[model samples]
Target: MSSLISTPIAPTSHTLLKPNRNTLLRGDSLLPKRLSCTRTRSSSTTRALLSTTKESVLKDFHERRALKIISGLQNLNKENVASVVTAADKGGATHVDIACDPDLVKLATSLTSLPVCVSSVDPAAFSAAVEAGALMVEIGNYDSFYEMGIVFSPEQILNLTKETKRILPSMTLSVTVPHTLSLPDQIKLAEQLEQEGVDIIQTEGGKGSSPSKPGVLGLIEKATPTLAAAYAISRAVKIPVMCSSGLSAVTAPMAITAGASGVGVGSAVNKLNDGVAMIAEVRSIADSLSLSTGRHIVSEKNTLRL
Candidate 1:
């Protein structure tokens, strides 16, 4: 028998968090125009890109415009992770993603009141996170694997999902589908992951993309890979799809329109040197998500080649 222990509750389709609608941003007085200028997206373009026909009911957490701030798995400095985690909670993000190190989990939970989600490729690692107060366990956040020239095959991902479920049978689990596979393959894996009882499926591909356009077009270019995956995966899986990697305030709404219930933003918030800027970026993405959620629109001219 495995060392892991828990009362395996049936998984629900929502994140462990429930963000307040525009709660911190409203208090911060973040303006759409400020976001438009800083992010290189036009408000008119936002309206156009966000306009969509509703296809399904999103999980209740999605209606709140889920934003999860990622403190990179490689980022282990308690002070740095604490800054990101604090900003996430202060800015009204639904949760904070940290390295799956149990000490990091303890450090993160101590910094913020927001629910904690721990990311690691190791299933056995999640047990410590659970003991350290991680509300959810994630088997994928593949961006770190890319710099080392490693790619996760579908079979490996499924095995990880299985092993993770075995270890933390009762913990809320989210798995990421590597964008290395074709869109069809991605959709297929997402369907299978859901069957494995994953509560959420995250999509990542920023490292695989090379944007040719300038300004806002470039921003859209960078986000295309994950957005395409979200579009396909959301349609195929009942579990929520979190569009992550290479996403920005400009493209966050597009992810929501593409069928992602929430977005996992990393560099946008974590890369900032100051907590105030980090908080502003989180609010900007949240604001963008809120404006376009529950309403999906295809732009008049296809902004994305996909």
Candidate 2:
């Protein structure tokens, strides 16, 4: 009788231990499920935060009077970059664009409150700059490349836009339609980019124009291609069109009149050797945009009264 009781008791103890092991395994499996849920929620929260940031940064664009000052896509000089950024901030410009460098982004951000935009042809390069504090990324800036006889086709630009959107879906993206393309193709590309979720379509034509006259008429002639592009693309798509390249205070308001939501001045401000001159140029463009906006408002009011 004692042997029988002992053997059964040992077997019962083994059964109890086996159930405890199974219970531990089940709890461990549930931990992974809980962790996955936590990760998903964290990702959702992060996307929401980025979306909010994008909206706040683009407020000026939504107002149809954004003045962007470009520090040149190829410009890597920190001193020059600092001067341009300071000019944009003090000169009443709404945004500043610089080369896509993390260090430069940090420098620009440190110098001004205006939203810093980083320009790069490499889609992979934009992430670090954005992480460093850039609020926007531009894919065009094809002027330097054009000088090298390099040009981007419509397919290439579209692919770049798609890749950039894939990499940073929540960040504000501005795609510049190459001035090398015909006006119809430019419009087509702009429409496609808007479908791809691009926030802004920038038109560039500085390199293509050869102004015969050397003054204000020359400026208008220089801006003609970009202005036409802005007008066509703005009407073609609901997205904002930014007229860039070969733009100055004289032609900046003309850009607004021609249907551009904003203007981007690069060589006009970046080409100046003096910081005060850069600021003055930016202020001139900003004042032009301001006056244009004022005139537009009054025109609308008067029309309403009529």
Candidate 3:
């Protein structure tokens, strides 16, 4: 049986703009007040329907200690795909994230039952990834885009999510809240993604010409933006928020403490020469996260199906 499972369709495109930059608050800020009012005013019947579905939906992937491993950008090479799956399986990674390439998805799905998440900037590429057996999809995993003078603005990222949702409404969707934004902008985009029915919200750090650092200091620096975003978004949205990009074992638990439901570590594991070492690293990170959060890492038997 496959690890990937499909859930019911989420809401269609619904955009709510926060008070724009330079807009006067007039009184105590109204965004949160208004959102709370909306939730409060939602008919009891509607709330009950949502509660029923949310109860069935697993939002605590992190509380369950599911550490998702995103194979390194370098691992997108066709030759490294098998090793990526091997590492993910041995390390107890819930899924692997790959580039939106058909061959990679086919190879990854064939190699493991774990869900495969494909990343790309193009709508066509994301659509292809979903069709090619990717159980989930991500946009704005565009380190390369930043290098080429392309920045993923809030408008662009939200538009991508809207377009992707229109194409694959039933697929699990995780939208990256661009790290390029200031802390406030990141929070707003995250909430927007949540309103647009994003199943997951991911945040990253600096991009393009940015030196990739690993271990403690690097993890802390890289995690700063995503961690802030996670802290803000987790409370703002009902969906899960994941911290990604420059994360490591040391900071994995920190991320959880900062309100992340889970984490997506890319270069930390996939950059290793030996798959076993990579797996071991992932396991250590997962173990650290489990200990810090006081949550038991779900055994394979205990891993609840969505």
Candidate 4:
């Protein structure tokens, strides 16, 4: 009978109700609203830094006599990939474009501090390549298909946007339109690509066409294809447009004047095996573009400078 009486336990104070080991270490030091405000300020600071860096880099790249060599290295082997990227870097390339292969991406990332771009026919492969460390991605290098009997029609190009968006919604997408299309079609495709959320729309010279070659330069000759696509796409979309494939230092200014935000050249750098020679070529192109850009800037500043 004496042992049957039950004693009631006193309620512990809230302060004494200690949190679990996990909970104890997981509390935020600031209130939710304050935390959010602090995060916003930090984000703004970071963004400002990044923007300033990008502007300075672009300015220097434009102001100096250097062409951003977009060297195309299709080899899947890691060692070959490293060698090509290393050569491009020593040659003064702004960025390197590699085929969609995971090993190549790792090699590129490890070998150089330059921006890495991944090109792929498969959206999933592009995603993997980006995850592997690619800062950019190019959808077309039409030269690969020239002999494969595979053509990158307007429809096919548009479908690529749909697929890429579905797979990698936030990726910085760059879609290239085959130069084979007529000017009208090229413009139309450029407009469509812009509307589809592509970050950059590149135009090529199409079918054995070198934009600067003696007579084969249909669009490349009159500065029609790349210029047309850039003008159309730049006007249609807020994203940047790059004129690539057949561009050179001599014609780079025209490409920029026609509305290209940047130009991408492959053969001008890739065909050369010497890094120093490559850098010199890029530097010459960069110099030409900078001088031209400087003239435009001076004209605009003349009114203000006075």
Instruction: List the candidate 3 regions with Cα displacement exceeding 4 Å.
Output: 1-64, 72-75, 206-215, 291-306
Q: For each candidate, what TM-score against the reference?
A: 0.75, 0.83, 0.72, 0.67
Best by TM-score: 2
The lDDT values for all models are 0.77, 0.85, 0.69, 0.64
Clashing pairs in 1: 51-296, 51-297, 52-296, 52-297
Candidate no. 4 TM-score: 0.67
For model 4, the superposed segments whose C-alpha errors exceed 4 Å read 1-68, 77-84, 206-224, 291-306
- Please identify which of the two predictions, 1 or 4, would achieve the higher TM-score against the true structure: 1
Arrange candidates by lDDT, descending: 2, 1, 3, 4
Using lDDT as the measure, name the better of candidate 2 and candidate 4: 2
* Runs with alpha carbons beyond 4 Å of true place in candidate 2: 1-41, 291-306
Error of 4 at 195 (Å): 1.9
Candidate 1 local lDDT, 109-155, one digit each (tens)? 78887778889877766776777887777877777667766777788
Error of 1 at 167 (Å): 1.0
Model 4 per-residue lDDT at 5: 16
Please provide, for model 3 over 1-306, each residue's C-alpha lDDT reduced to its tens digit, 9 standing for 90 to 100.
212122233333322212335444333355478755665666466657545543333344635455677764334677666776778766767668888887889999888877788887655565556657776777756565555565766776777788777766656778888676777888888888888988888878734214367555665776676677778878888888887777777777787888888888877776787878887887788677763234343443367652
Residue pairs in collision within model 3 = none
Better of 3 and 4 by lDDT: 3
Question: Cα miss at 149, model 3 (Å)?
Answer: 2.6
